[model samples]
Target: MTDIPLEHVHVAPEDGSDGEPAPAVFVLHGRGADEEDLLPVAAELPDDRHVVSLRAPDPLQGGYTWYELDLSAGGLESSQPDAADFRRSLDLIVESVEAAVDAYELDADRIGLLGFSQGAITSLSLLLEDPDRYAWVVALHGYLPESHADLDPDGIEGKPVFVGAGAGDRVIPDSRTSAAVERLEAVEAAVTHGSFPGGHGIGPQELEAVVEFVESQAR
Candidate 1:
């Protein structure tokens, strides 16, 4: 995969409550979704933090895709080029997060990641790949990659992880979600799992839980 330059959309919190540099939340959107879709939700988060919603690099049939897929090829197989692209994009994200941490003068230990659907999967992958990089991870309607069996358990030990999924989620099966939880637990992650009554999406209760999770980590 080519090392394409990275670009992002950033939203800073409104002024006046705390003098502390705001902790940042990096958001990733679902397949076929753009950076704009997740920014408003980031704004709704507690006002004490900075939020950045990133755009995927690979261009799909008119829109952007974090990776490539072939349905006929079966079972979540990402192209080599796409996987390489994702790795490069992830590296860029880490750099950006570090820069934001320094620029905002925020608590480095408080930085977090929040992702939806495909973004959520990416967040889980990144956290499992490099444990100490993020203080907390919030994944909504997403499951861990099947390839995670190869990851070293020590990488995610003691990391705080929050996962929310709908009992009726058609996109992500309950079995997959359960397996993800099991894998995370096996790795000694501090995991909190939530299940809502709806389908394949976030609801108010899930949002509240996420806010609480992040706030708790910030403190």
Candidate 2:
């Protein structure tokens, strides 16, 4: 199990000047990153919504992680984290989103998720398992987690999703990316897939695409 407990999360409040209940976007970081890690991306995103970033629950090396991993055991796709621990992380993310909505008076119809790597795992899991709660998703350099195998594909039809992957990423092979897209589409998610000419990380080009995707979703 993870040693670090998730008690505090970081949030960037929105300035809703239009006297409307602005939408809120929950930002989740990759493993080994903190709540503030994705704040810059949040800055680049549309400023119309509240940007709340969540930290994972487990401690690792000098950073934190969503769950334990066995990297050398044939890469991430085959490797699995503790199921119970994964479930808890999933629940905590949902709780954080709900709490933010209540505290900020956010529009219930405009909540979204943005995640990278392990954060992608958590965000994707929550959105897939409970499609009704999230309006859209943006997952960066990630694949489906093992615990999410039982999601009903028909549960999230017509939902918008943005998937950004690295074409040269040695960590998560293209096979995994293809599978992820297939799975999301099987559930009938309108996936706007983009590939960058990089390896295992998000680039400026990809971020531009993501920003465009986020804007389109808001409309």
Candidate 3:
């Protein structure tokens, strides 16, 4: 097993890389979910890309969470992340990406991030922190964290970002996703927003759009 920074499951490229470093898409699941939760979705992505699904570091409830949520403000809509835990998790993800690149023989220039909910939030934060590090990002049912208020990194100009939101999602609310889209657009990232007709999860159409997005990048 190629040891990276986090617990993960690596899915090899269906089409061999032909001795060249292959592109990779790293998967990050939502809170209360594990690495295996998104394997099915990962399977639908481009076959030429290596898929690495990572388990969150901190165990929570029966699953795992990228970081703890501060619900003291009331419902999930008002909840914010514990800043310290968020930063720590971000650092760990960065380390894991570096290790994954070397161990998996991945093309570092084509790294993509696909995340859900809290995982989506982390992906957006990572892109903002170091836009040049990632080629594209897909965040489903997630919002930009408040901790990034002072962060406005350069080099993110024209970065591709996909923000997906559910119209009836009470857990995250569509407004939050809209705000994230605005923020990404303000930063000059090429933002493609998709709205589903369901609640806090990815629907069939949403998944299709995600696949299409990843396919475009893979080619």
lDDT of each: 0.74, 0.78, 0.91
Off by over 4 Å in 2: 1-15, 70-73, 153-155
TM-score of 1: 0.83
Tens-digit lDDT track for model 3 on 19-85? 9999998999999999999989989887888999999999988999998989888888988888889
TM-score of each: 0.83, 0.89, 0.97
Error of 3 at 49 (Å): 0.4
Q: After superposition, how far is residue 78 of candidate 2 from its true place, in Å?
A: 2.7
- Candidate 1 lDDT, 1-219, residue by residue in tens: 113134577677776336766667888887778778777668777877777777787676665767654344445432122456566767776776776666656667767899988788888888988888788898888777655545775558788999888888887766567777888888889999988888877778878888788768744
Task: For candidate 2, give the lDDT.
Answer: 0.78
Q: After superposition, how far is residue 207 of candidate 3 from its true place, in Å?
A: 0.4
Ranking by TM-score: 3, 2, 1
* Clash count list over all predictions: 0, 0, 0
lDDT of 1: 0.74
Query: What is the Cα-based lDDT of residue 173 in candidate 2?
Result: 65
Of 2 and 3, the candidate ahead on TM-score is: 3
